[model samples]
Target: MNTFFHIWKYPILLALLTMFGLLAALIGTGVWHVLSWITLTIPAIVCIRFGMFPKNK
Candidate 1:
C-alpha cells in the first residue's frame, strides 16, 4: 500500500481531480443537464467506497 501510494499518488490525484473538475465545470449547460446526475454515480460511488470506508486487515 505504501509503495503503491508512493509511486502512483500524484497521478491518481491528478486524474481524479481532473475528472471531478470536468464534471463540476459542466453544470448548467445542455449536455451537463443531460449527463448532470448520471455521470455523478462514478465519483459518488468511488468516494463512498474508498473515502468513507476501508476493508479490515
Candidate 2:
C-alpha cells in the first residue's frame, strides 16, 4: 500500500486536477476559466519539465 501510494500519488493528483480543469472550463463562467487554466497548466508544466530534462538512468 505504501509503495503504491508513493508511486501513484502525484499521478492521481494530476489526473484529478486535469478533470477539474476540464469541468471548470466546460461548466464555469468568469473566475472558473482562470481556475481551469491554472489547474491545467500544472500538469502541462510537469510534462514539459520531464520531457525536456528527464533524469538519466
Candidate 3:
C-alpha cells in the first residue's frame, strides 16, 4: 500500500493522469475537439504558471 501510494504521488501522478486524459480525448473523440484542446492546454498552462522553466535569480 505504501509503495502504491508512493508510485501515485503528486506531480508525477498528476502529470501522468493529465497526459492520459489528453491522449484519451485525442484518440476517443467524435466532436470533442474543443475539449481535447482544453485538456491538453490546461496542463501546459499549469506548468507555465508554476514556472516549469527555471529562471535566473
TM-score of each predicted structure versus truth: 0.42, 0.90, 0.44
Best model number under TM-score = 2
Query: Residue 38 in candidate 3 has what lDDT?
Result: 66
Clash pairs detected, candidate 2 = none
| 10 residues in a row with least lDDT, candidate 1 | 33-42
Between prediction 1 and prediction 3, which has the larger TM-score?
A: 3
Residue 31, candidate 1: how far off, in angstroms? 18
Candidate with better lDDT, 2 vs 3? 2
Candidate with best lDDT: 2
- Give lDDT per model, in order: 0.64, 0.96, 0.69
**Residues 1-57, model 1: lDDT tens digits:** 699888988567656755765676465677665554555565666668877798675
Q: How big is the positional error of residue 18 in model 3, measured in Å on the Cα after superposition?
A: 3.3
Per TM-score, what order, best first? Answer: 2, 3, 1
**TM-score of structure candidate 3:** 0.44
Instruction: Score residue 56 of candidate 2 by CA lDDT.
Output: 88
